[model samples]
Target: MRNILIIGATRGLGHSLALQYAKKGMVVYATARYSTPQTPSHGIHWIANVDVSHEGAGRRIAAHWEEETKIDLVVISATYFASETFEDLHWDKEVAMYKTVAIGPVFLIQHLVHSGLLKKNSRIVLVGSENGSIGLRHESGGAGNYGGHGSKAALNMVGKLLSIDLKPKEIPVAIVHTGYLRKENKEGFFEHGGVVKPDEAATALREWLESFDMSKTGEFWAVRGPADIKTAEVVLGPLDTLPTPLQLPW
Candidate 1:
């Protein structure tokens, strides 16, 4: 079985992805922030106290991996979101969010590569959002969420740089938007807002990566196409004419 490492697997898309991968009998290693792995048990091997926000997170993660095991896929799914308007911006929250969303993944991947856990065929997926897209932001016309949107954009840039740096090793690095997800069904949340449950979004992302290769490295994509994007038609022309997996603009 192939070895897969998923960071931030305690909840949301990360949790769903870990469970699904474990159920498929892949050698799944997952990380959690708690001193004890608080994630629901589903045969996933846990790496506890791995908070991606800290600079030491990568080193902590590296210590847990066995020398004999080389990871086939590394999914950096750890994310922090803090909604902020100019009037009420929280400094601490924004800093934490930026570190988790953009800076932390760098150190984690740096450690993984330095530890020789990744081989040529290994791929890295940085979970980004369409909210990162400046073009979309202009068309969609929503204000606020500065930290959330800004950090994701930073993540895309970080992923691009990583792809360039790792090109010699042929490790394909992709930045992707999973979807607008609903962790739980809230009132009218599942009605028509294009919000999918975590499981469904995870599956869509998994399928999208089947054909992703080195040629597409450093590219940003919406794993489920442009259907869920608020301004897809305005930016990408006609929605029905677009492909299932859409390449996003940075």
Candidate 2:
């Protein structure tokens, strides 16, 4: 079975992915700040207290994978979006926002690559958002308190560059824009008038992972439905000024 490493697995989409993969008989290394769920025993190894932004976090994760088997799949699901207004926060908090949102994933990828934990055919999936699409403006005009829109936009470009780098090595990288989920109820975004459910999002991610093909490396897909029906080029604008991955001030 494939060995899967899922970050942010304590709750939300990450939690659902961890449980689903474990049920499919894969060895899942689930990581999160808090404790993972303990209801069913499905051969899931919960790795807690993981802070991806820390310097040694990647090394620690790599070592853990070495202890058993290399990770075939890496799912980055952890993210932070504080409701802090630009006026209320200091520079330090701003840096922290980018750190948790962008830098953490970049560092983790670098660590995994350098640690020799990822196999040639290994797949890395970045959970991204439509908010990142520079050209794609939400009907709501992005009045949300969290910085999710900008952060997700930055992640999409990172995936593009990563795909270009990993393709020659036969490894594929992808970013999935898991539509807005109802944070509380974990249901469809439209059903609740643009609120998405974590469980539903997780289910979509699992389906995508199951059908992944190396040829589709560096591609971005909508997590809600028929990928072909929705074109990213139409949604995401040019990436001229997009933030570089891991370059955040944090």
Candidate 3:
């Protein structure tokens, strides 16, 4: 049985991945800051009050995992989003978001890999967004609401470097950019085809992870696809394809 470790599994994609994996009889170790109280099942395990942003936090998690089993699939599914423009965005807040979306996962993965808690044929998946694609402009001032776009761009680089580092170990890494989830659409980024269900996104992620070829490492896939999102597009064209979502490495 594959052991999957999901970081930041409180809600949305993370929560859905945890629940679905547990239902499928896979061992799921799910961590979150806060989660709705629920009964534990045979396959579902929970670790609460895990503030991933804390220094040395990854080591703590690794230490905890040393007690039982090694993980086969590591999912860094935690993300933070904001809608402030460059002039209006706070530097402190942006840095914090960067840590949450970028550095936190880097540290966590570093620790996990170093702990030797990963088995052969292991896979690492980082959840990211299209906003992070470099120099890709949104025609209608599209995803520029806040720093979500820029932070994602930073994550792209992180994903690339991580892939390079992990490749030698035969551990394939993939970064997926899921469509804007329904719950996060309070701002109506969904007026265009942005209405994919949370469950759908999670299912896509699971499928991709299961079917991914190690040779495809460092690829960024758009979940819930119309296959519309393109990689290596220097210029993001008009928003004609309202929800042609993309994922960038980082």
Q: Judged by lDDT, which candidate is best?
A: 1
lDDT of 3 by residue, 1-250 (tens): 4688888887788888888998898888888766534755456677766666666757767766633667888888777776676557677777778888878888888888888876557888888876666554545435444557666776777888888888888888877877667665556434346456668889888876667657868877776553334433325334454343443333
Best by TM-score: 1
**Could you tell me the TM-score of candidate 2?**
0.79
Error of 1 at 226 (Å): 1.0
lDDT scores in order: 0.86, 0.69, 0.71
- Indicate whether candidate 1 or candidate 3 has the larger TM-score: 1
Candidate 1 lDDT by residue in tens digits, 6-111? 9998877888898898888888888988764543677788999999988888788778886487889989898888778879988899888899999999988988
Ranking by lDDT: 1, 3, 2
Candidate 1 similarity to native, TM-score: 0.93
Using Cα atoms with residue i matched to residue i, what is each candidate's TM-score against the true structure? 0.93, 0.79, 0.82
In model 1, residue pairs whose N, Cα or C atoms come closer than 3 Å (at least 3 residues apart or on different chains), thus clashing, are none
Stretches of candidate 2 exceeding 4 Å from the true structure? 34-41, 66-68, 84-90, 138-140, 143-146, 185-191, 226-250
lDDT of 2: 0.69
Worst 10 residues of 1 by lDDT: 183-192
